[model samples]
Target: MATILKRASKGKAGYGKIQFCGEQARRDGLQYFWVDTCCIDKSNACYVYLPDVSQSSSVLADNSNESWESFRKSEWFRRGWTLQELIAPASVDFFSREEVLLGNKTSLEQDICETTGIPATALRGSALSDFSVAERMSWTECRETTYKEDKAYSLLGIFDVYMPLIYGEGKDRALRRLREEIDKASRGTSLFKREDFSVSFSLSDVSDVEHFVARKIELVKIHKALGVDGSRRVVVLHGLGGIGKTQLTVAYAKRHKDDYSGIFWLNIKDENSLKQSFVKVAKQISREHPLALRLSNVDTNENLDDVVDAVKEWLSLLNNKRWLMIYDNYDSPKLPGKTDPTVVNIREFLPELY
Candidate 1:
């Protein structure tokens, strides 16, 4: 590993890396390849000093009896330039001092975790975004960089954000900028589309999420189906009660409320509730939608069906606006019998969008 590192840092790129990378990219049907070591910006590079193991450091030798430290503490481990090389790659292979075939990061993860103090999942090359800010920061707790600015710059790929080089800025400010960029990235639109159900979304509703794990992957699939690609624009999650479907949706809304223009949760647990919720929602939609108020002529004599029909009409329109509607707890088609012409099933009230 040390020999290869030395050669990689040398003035000449003599390892046949260019041809090898080009061939590998071609085999993978890719247009190009990127090698960080080959194209490093030496202007922003950090240096590491390796010592001869056979001869101890003269300063340590001169002092009284002292314990020997292995090359694990070498500058290579501490240099800021090396952290990304260790982490950002999908997989990293390690070779012995004799250059014999050893193993890749996955094949020897336990040792890597014990040595580096990084979590096994991260060492296995999980997306940096999958881990929290604190978890990512802890990976570099003891690592070092020659320039204060490189400490933050080194983590650019880890956080998956790009900022202009500001070498003179102190480490604190640079790190601050890095975190700001990460926060901006975290705010990117998620698939959890929410409809305005006559009430503002409350994070408190999902505050009890400690006991419930986030079903983000499932929610993402549903989000993509309902929100993306402009096809199959409607989705229904049908299952027996107490299956965590509602909680999963609430968790998605709480986590990604900022991504959507609006979020609406309809309590279609029963027909009366569904109709009432729809009428209430129509009044709210009337403020923004041109057709809603005209259709919802809420005279004292107006029937409940009139309001529901008006609300459905407002929702079915094809517009540039984006919103998510959850027809929650739709366990049965039969509405709780109430008025003269009872609400029979869900198909009757739903919007008619293709």
Candidate 2:
């Protein structure tokens, strides 16, 4: 007679339980038994006992009513294979049974735990002991927090401040307003699109500038002179504000983005803004906030000495990799005090480039 192996419901038994059952069946004069856990493992043993269910039961029954409610709501218990069917050898096929059971267990746990405020262990017992309940709880909590955060800044709420203009618009105009609102909420960080490498420029109406052509040539020359040896080089394109300085920089960045491994463009219109922008850029590239590196206490006007130090440190590390740092509209007042004195003369930030 073929061996009869019993498997606990997907979430109620581990590999050891299934293996023990198969081994027991074989010892009882059965020729073959379809057991996922034992079949998947080469060496099989019968002495192993089912894992202790007391710990998980305590966690679940600590809040008995809640646990029962959660268990009832659980997709695993409510759906296809019953606990009896899982343990019945004649009910399921040997091949691929484990996969289907495990998938169902996982999906059910996630769905039930998310919908009902219940501890997962109580619903399925000690079967899925290896999975971390705390980690799943943390992830679910984070998602909930993010959703609630997004709700605080609703369209109606923002419209109250920018009112008449937002409501007086047509569908296309309303969409533009909505985009601006979303951009503001995201701190204007949505400037880059993944599909194409391009920078935002306000020189759309400038005809005589020929910004794109001029910057492309400059970028090629800069890349060639810098060579592929991976040395950091600074090319300062300084001119009057409206004379396409920003446009030229944006064009250069887009054209030569592929030449370098990483490219970052920053608009430093003021000293404080410059510091904040640098910190943001540093966080994006290095995964560490500049202020968090050394200073614990950070405020708006607390002197950006820490920020300048952080940027210098990051730049030194990246000296081995080719990078371009475009400082757009950097001629604002208070620039001298914000920049490093060792880098250039205090009279103007322009001398730093030289």
Candidate 3:
């Protein structure tokens, strides 16, 4: 048998509204009201049917369970729309208790109606007979229970059951965090340069390479140790293209990004390109050009040495603060039968301090 139960609380104001609906039903000339409080034996906690009585049976005298249900067939359930209009005093308090017991940490002021897509006013009343109170109780317990208790399965196991009802649009945020964790595990190199240095891709996106994770971890340790050292060290990460060298440095920069005061990534593919990249990095770090007009005086008149000196001076000023200079793709030759001047100059600029 399908049963509907309402949590009743005495001395509550909302229950009076249910009584108002019942009075309206009586004024509308309805014969009987299927009010659970009067219809069911609350003392015994059992479902009992009530029968009808004639005019000889006064309404006050017909207070027994047998008189009410017999007076109205389906109409007993329909009188004044009590099924939709009745207020259950315990509805809000039950959900509040469930939320606390479940440890959801959601605010009581939060519009659960908006989040769950249930009408706020409808929930204010105890009119939801179609919903199962047992199911709600189980859901509350499942959410509040920690993974430590259910060790055999992860929290995802519990989430799968109630996700449909509980998570409306908020499911996306949970999925996004999950994807980030999966990516961090799979990539082995926590390096992705978005607006935030936090890794963004999943493990499936990273290439399979031996010692990739180890190499990145070692780089992080080196970066940390270098940060502590009063003197700056220009650690050049060099390897064949696509050997994951750039990826390693980028990952290192991202991991220890907070430790360093500033980080500059320069792609030194050619002489002119390298100079432009350095100027951009210089501007980002220093925020103002020390020799702005001189550098912008003429297009071809700008000497590579001067630009390199400016970058060196900027690095020098950051002696009290830690900084990272990432020189990417520094494999090109400067001229015919000549080594890249940019690489040679970078080494010269990064002087070892005593």
**lDDT leader:** 1
Ranking by TM-score: 1, 2, 3
Query: How much RMSD separates candidate 2 from the native structure?
Result: 20.8
lDDT of 1 by residue, 1-354 (tens): 334545575456434443444444466466544554632332221111233222234433443323223333345556666767766566564433323223456765665676677788776556566665545665676778889888788888766689998989887678778867765776644321222322234434222446888666897887677763433256877777877877888877777676564566677877888777776666555433322334435542357787777766665655424556667777656645645344447777777674
Query: Number of clashing residue pairs in every model?
Result: 7, 0, 4
Better of 1 and 3 by TM-score: 1
**If both were scored by TM-score, which would come out higher, candidate 2 or candidate 3?**
2
- Candidate 1 steric clashes: 7
lDDT of 3: 0.40
Q: Pick the TM-score winner.
A: 1
Clashing pairs in 2: none
Weakest 10 consecutive residues of candidate 3 by summed lDDT: 94-103
Quantify all predictions' global Cα lDDT against the true fold. Answer: 0.58, 0.40, 0.40
Q: In angstroms, give how far residue 274 of model 2 lies from its true place.
A: 1.0
